[model samples]
Target: LAPMLERTTSAVVNISTTGKVVVRDPFFNDPLFRRFFDVPRQRRERRISGLGSGVIFDADDGYIVTNSHVIDKAEDIVVTLENGQRFDATVIGKDPGADIAVIQVEADNLTEIPLGDSDDLRQGDFVVAIGNPFGLGQTVTSGIVSALGRSGLGIESYEDFIQTDASINPGNSGGALVNLRGELIGINTAIYGSGGNIGIGFAIPVNMAKQITAQLLEHGEVRRGRLGFVVQDLTPELAEAFGVAHKKGVVVARVEAKSPAQKAGVRVGDIIVSVNGREVENSAQVRNEIGLLRVGAQVQIEVLRNGKTRTLTASVGKQLKQTVSGKSLSDKLAGAKLSEAPEDPSRGTAAGIQVVKVEGRAASAGIRKGDIIISVNRKRVKTVSDMKAAIKKNPKTLLLNIQRQRQGLFILIR
Candidate 1:
């Protein structure tokens, strides 16, 4: 263990970040006093500090990998080495969905850790975790791989975690989880216990990190594949209804029109069995499989459709970043594709336009996909056309009655 520690400890780093956040006061916008009394227009600034850990994967190029949450909203980041040397770091790229981030520092005589195959990890294999726990200098703990491919934890959008019993605390985030050979197999990320290690910790697989880091290095952001489809876990009843042989699949709930999935003939109720030759047991697995692929990459999807297995090929599409130009109300609502709400007897579907893709003011106002706009300015809107007509009335502020996940909401868009 000493020899391996000597070989790998240099790659582990202690990360510290500082930033300023606006402290909002409740009286800043007091309408009663604003009419007569003079109010200060300035808001107070509060300094925030955070501590975490990181790994130096590329020593010569000075590329350091860490969790996205570590340096999120950080104005200044500094990475300290095992030898007490520190360097100012700059964020290269980050993927919040995956909780992975890459930062770079210009330094000399740094050490790089050897990357290992996370796919080769087996349960009960010995592993070591190195990080700065609770802001206490560098700490190391040993444990075995308790599980693999753990998901559905709601830790991130895409979760393919490697579970371990290593003592990973709050400050252990983004630290290195290495194999016995001193090869980095994972990045220590989260613990299931209350703010401390309870022998149940999760790590990001090194293979996934490698792919993300490569893309971040090249494009400054990961261009992940988007199939433009919504999926739900396949239940026994759904499997039987879809005539699927087994329940180990995801059922397509909705496919966006004009999307790659729709272009490839994918339809609702199709049971997705495999993606790119990899079997997916649930919607999360499907997302993890396709979300890691580069945009424009071709994926072969095998689905059980109408009791028959069919293969469809699709090229991943990129989400359009639409911006509004004109000042008209229609322009404010432009770039969003809407569809009529699907009928559901169980919930009694609402009469409204389901927001599929949103941009411009609609997105700026926090309108999200899947939100059903039931009324525009108190007038019932059963379709996109009705909503448009109501908006064309040119109200200074549009009050949207929205139904989100069966909950009603009122949002004002100006």
Candidate 2:
């Protein structure tokens, strides 16, 4: 254990961050009332600090990996090496949805930790965690791999966590989770043990971290393709309704007209079993798999429709940029361009017109620039003509079915 610690500890660094937080007085909201009552409207700013740990993966390049939440809203960051050498650091890239970040510092002769394949790990494997637990300096804890592929815990938008019984605490975020050979297999991220290590801690698999970090290094932000369809998990009831033997794949609820999925011949009621040859069990898995691929990349999608499994290839497209501007449309839409909705509807690609612009009454009513107006007054509208016909009825309250980013919701336009 001592020899293993000696080899890996040098690559682990302690991170400290500081920033300013602004606080406004409650009376600031009602200045007139405050003046009438002789109350002071004041604002205050205070300095906040944070501490965490990071691993030096590329010593020669001074590349380090850590948790995004550790440095979030931090104005100044400092990295301290095992030998007590401290240097200022800058953020290279970050994905908040994944809770992972890459930072760089100007240093020389740093020791780098060997990265191991997380997929090679199995249950009952011996693993060690090294981190600055609770800010009590560098600490080490031994544990076994309790589980793998833990997801849907609401920890992050993308979750493929490694569960362990390691002693991870508040300052342990972004620490190193290593195997018997002292190779990094995961990055310590979150703990479900309340305020301390209650024999349950989670880490982001090194495989996922490596992919996200590389993208961040190249683009400074992760860009994902929009499939132009909505899907739901294959529930047992849905399986019965779809006449399938078992609930094994995700069901395509709707496909955006003229979108990539439609162009690839994807349709409603298709049970998607795999993407790019990788089997997907749920909607989130499909999203994550497809999202990792770059725009314009062609992927093969396999689906079960009408009791037949077929594969279709699609060229991924970029997500529509969300801006409050676009070409003008008819008066009924209130100056917004009513076009085909781009992404998912809450109800999985409901028939609707996408609002490319938000002007006039629609803008005033909180109708965002990219909102997809799926229906009006319980009438489904797939195009500008359909919307016009629906508006001609002059319903007292226009109940609109809007799809934004594939989630369905009803918005009332009165």
Candidate 3:
């Protein structure tokens, strides 16, 4: 263990970041109160700093992999090697949905860790976690893989995690989880407890990280594609009813018109046994597999239809995120940018317009980014067209029903 640590620790680097965040006050934002008190109209900002860890996986190209959260909104990033050498780092790319980011530094004689196949990992496999916990510098902790294919933790948009009992804590994010052979198998990410290790930690499997890193390096963002089909988990009762021998699969609930799935002959009640030759057990796994694929990529989907196994080939389609300027729709909505909400297969297409940006009149009317406009003037609006029609019906008053995170509110613009 000591020999392996001696070789691998050099590849694990400490990451620190500095950025600024706006500090907003309701009283300061009020124009009437500001005028009455003669308060300055300038927004306030405060400097912020953060600490984390990273792995130098590509020494030749100087590419380092870390969690996106570690470098989110960072104005300046610094990487410190185990030998006390520091270098300024620049962002190559990031995927917030997957929580993986790649940074690069121009330096010489950097050691790179060997990549291991995380697909080969199993439950109870001996593994080691190396990171800078609590900004305490390099630290190594040993534990066995507690579980594999862990999901539904709501940690990330893609939730296939490698669960371990290793002692991962604050500042350990973006570190390396290695097998006994000193091969990198996972990226240390989240823990079960609140800002502390509670014998339950999760890491992004190396295979998934590798896939995301390749996309980020090539495109600077994860361009997720979709098959345009809805699916549900295959239950034992459904399997019995469908006369399928295996219950571990997903059932196609709906296939969108003119979609890739429909073109490939995917139908409702079809049991999706595998995607691109990899067997799937639930809807999330299917979603993850398809979401990681690039647009125009061909996929082989095997389905169990009417007790007969059939394979279909389909091309992945680019997910459409339509955006429109608020001024195009209504004058009261000026200075806001609206886009179609992300689609959720389980809930079909999302029925609202997401406020991607807000300023001026829209911001003054209490509109904000990330707020979903579910209705306008008491009429439901799902898309830009729907919103346009709703606003046209009632041009005098703009009544917006907004869904902000877990809360709902109403804002009027006149």
Candidate 4:
């Protein structure tokens, strides 16, 4: 353990952060607010700190890898090596969908860890996790790989994680999950424990991290193709109803009127069993897989329709980027041709409200940015000017059928 610690601890770094942030009061006209408004507030924020661990992936010019959730939303980030030398780091690019990030620092002759093939790992393989757990500095604990090829946990958009019994805790996120040979097989990410190691842990597979990190560094974001179809998991009832031979592929819920799926001759009630040559186990898997394809990539698609298996080659379109990668990709959506709704209380937010206040029930209903309210409770939208007019024609709770870009869905907001 000492030799292992000595060999790798130099690459392990402690992250500290401080930032100047604005405090928005939920209430502005209250007496408490007025009393505090008279006092002069400092322009600079006080020292705020947090702890997490990272590994040196590239040491010559200083590149590191850690969990995106660790440094996400942080106003400032400072990294400290095992030698106590602190260097401020900048966020290069991050993918919340992947829970991985690449940070760069300046150093020479630094000992770095080599990434191990996560796909090569199996159950019962010895693993080690090192991190600044509980902020007590670098700590190392060992356990066996409890599971491999694990999926469907919904930990992130793309998950082929390696589950281990390794001791991962609060400060362990973004730490290195190394094999017995001290090679990094995965990034220590989530833990299912009672404030300590309960023999249940999860790590993002190294291959997934490598693919996303490389793409993010090159383009500042990742781009994938969109197959114009709404899909859901195959339930027992659905499986029986559809009479699918195997209940693994995603069942198409709906196809937009002018979507790529419709153009490609896809229809509702069609079971999308595979893409290219890979089998899709569920709807989320379908989304994740399709999202990995670049725009304009042509691929063979297999779908079960009318109890017959037919293969069709659909030309994939670029998916309007998801919000997880930040605003840099939003320009590819509409090129700044969007407008916000009026903020007057006369136009107070509604369940079917648009252009403002995306939180609450509507967003959970899966309403996303750039979606347009086509109808409220089946009432048709004639024009943008008639949205408020049409809303006044309906009741308090609205059942919005939204048209998001080329796809359509339902959003219930109040």
For lDDT, the strongest prediction is: 3
**187-298, model 2: which lDDT tens digit per residue?**
9999994788899999999998888988999999888777788888898999999999856789997787888999999999999999988788777678777777889999
Better of 2 and 4 by lDDT: 2
Instruction: For residues 1-414, write the lDDT of model 4, one tens digit per residue.
Output: 667667766777877656543332335533477587874422333444567889898888688888887886677788888888888888887877678888877766666887788768888998888888888888888898998756556456466678888888888988988876678888988887458778788988887777777777787777656777777777788989988777778777667677677888888888888988888876655766676777788878798988899898878886542222211212112211223222111112222224322432233345565455566667765344354455566645567676543456876644
After superposition, candidate 1 runs with Cα above 4 Å error: 30-36, 321-414
TM-score leaderboard ranking: 3, 1, 2, 4
lDDT of the candidates, in the order given = 0.84, 0.82, 0.90, 0.69
Rank all candidate structures by their lDDT, best first, as comma-separated numbers: 3, 1, 2, 4
Worst 10 residues of 1 by lDDT: 320-329
1 versus 2: better TM-score goes to: 1
For model 4, the stretches where C-alpha displacement exceeds 4 angstroms are: 1-10, 25-47, 147-160, 193-197, 306-308, 321-414
Please provide, for model 1 over 360-406, each residue's C-alpha lDDT reduced to its tens digit, 9 standing for 90 to 100: 44565668766778989888987556876888786666888998766
The reply for model 3, stretches above 4 Å from the true place, is 31-41, 240-243, 325-338, 342-351, 354-378, 390-414
- TM-scores of the models, in the order given: 0.78, 0.76, 0.87, 0.70
Model 2 poorest 10 in a row by lDDT: 323-332
